[model samples]
Structures are given as structure tokens and as C-alpha cells.
Target: MAGPTAAPTRREPTPDEFVAMQQSPEFQELRSTFRGFTFPVMIVAFIWYVVYVLLATFLPETMARPFLGLNVGLWLGLAQFLTTFLITWIYVRWANANIEPRAAHIRQEMEG
Candidate 1:
């Protein structure tokens, strides 16, 4: 009869190891790719939101224009929801295609 098995111990990476990992080309590329996508998207999304708010606040007349029984402001507000879903979908697709594989490889390398 076998005794109870011990759990495998996880080795923690040292700070130096973490620093080296951060300095690695693969890690650098991953960071660059992530920033490249996120920064622009964030900027554009912020600009879009600001534009919407400014229009609603300063140009109420324009926003009050009606179409199909809905005000333009209502449509723009709903568009924010649509934009959120669209950005989420786009980011998921982009991450699956670009970010995930590299991150998985890095994780495997770190684990091993």
C-alpha cells in the first residue's frame, strides 16, 4: 500500500528572474503589441464619449432631433452600448489571434 502523495511544490521566480523575463524580447514584443492596440482604442473611445457628452450638453437641439420616434441623443446613447459590445468582440478576436498565443508560450516557458 502506498502512503499519501505529497503535493508538488511550486518554485517562485526571483525578482532577478522576473526582471530578466520583463527584459526578454518576447515579453517586450507582447507589451508593445498590447499597448499598441489598447492605447489607440482607449484614446478613440474617450474621444467618442467626450464628443457624445459635449453634443448632448451643448447641442441639445441637435440631439433632440427625432428619427423613428427616438431622439438623436437616445440613438447616440444606445450606440455607446453597441460600441462597448463591438469593442469587446474586437478585443476578444484580436487577443485570441495576437496576444493569447504569445502569452501562453511565455507562461509555458516560465513554468518550465
Candidate 2:
């Protein structure tokens, strides 16, 4: 009769190993890819928000203009929410497709 098997322990990487991993081409590529997507998106989103705020603050009359039974400001406010959801959806899809596989591969290499 066989007894219960103990689970395998994962060994933590040493500080040098961590540094080496960070410097590896695969890790560097991953970081670059992530930044390439994130930085531009962040900049654009920030600019979009700033534009909205500026319009609402400095041009209340323009924001107050009526359109399709609702004011422009209200529509823009709703668009902000929509943009949030859309960005989240895009990030999830992009990560799953481009990021996850490379990350998994790197993790597997580190573990083994």
C-alpha cells in the first residue's frame, strides 16, 4: 500500500539569479513589449481626460450644448465610462494573446 506523497517544494531564486533573469533577453523583451503598449495608452488616456476636464471647466457653454436629448457634457461623461470599459477589455485581450505566453515561458524557464 502507498502512503500520501509530499508535495514538491519550489526553490526561491537567489539575488544574483534574479538579477540575471532581469537582464536576460526574454525578460527584457517582455518588459519592452509591455511598456510599448502601456506607455502610449497611458499618455493618450491622460490627454483625453485632460481635454475633457479643460472643456468642462473653461467652456461650460460648449459642454452645455444639447444633443439628442442630452447635453454634450453628459455624453462626454458617459464616454469616459465607456472608454474605461473598452480599455480594460482591450488590455485583457492583448495580455492574453501577446503577454501571457511569453510570461509563462519565462516562468517555466526560471522554475526549471
Question: TM-scores, in order shown?
Answer: 0.89, 0.90
lDDT of 2 by residue, 33-111 (tens): 9999989998998899999999999999999999999999999999999998899899999999999999998877777
* Root-mean-square deviation of Cα positions for candidate 2 versus the true structure, in angstroms: 2.5
Q: 31 in model 2: Cα distance from truth in Å?
A: 0.5
Global lDDT of model 2: 0.92
Roughly what TM-score does model 1 have, to 2 decimal places? 0.89
Instruction: Please report how far candidate 1 places residue 14 from its true position, in Å.
Output: 1.7
User: Residue by residue across 1-112, what tens digits does model 1's lDDT show?
Assistant: 9999998776677788888999999999999999999999989999999999999999999999997799999999999999988999999999999999999888777766
Give Cα distance to truth, residue 68, candidate 1, Å.
Answer: 1.6
CA RMSD, predictions in order: 2.8, 2.5
**Weakest ten-residue segment in model 1 by summed lDDT:** 8-17
Question: In angstroms, how far off is 58's CA in candidate 2?
Answer: 0.5
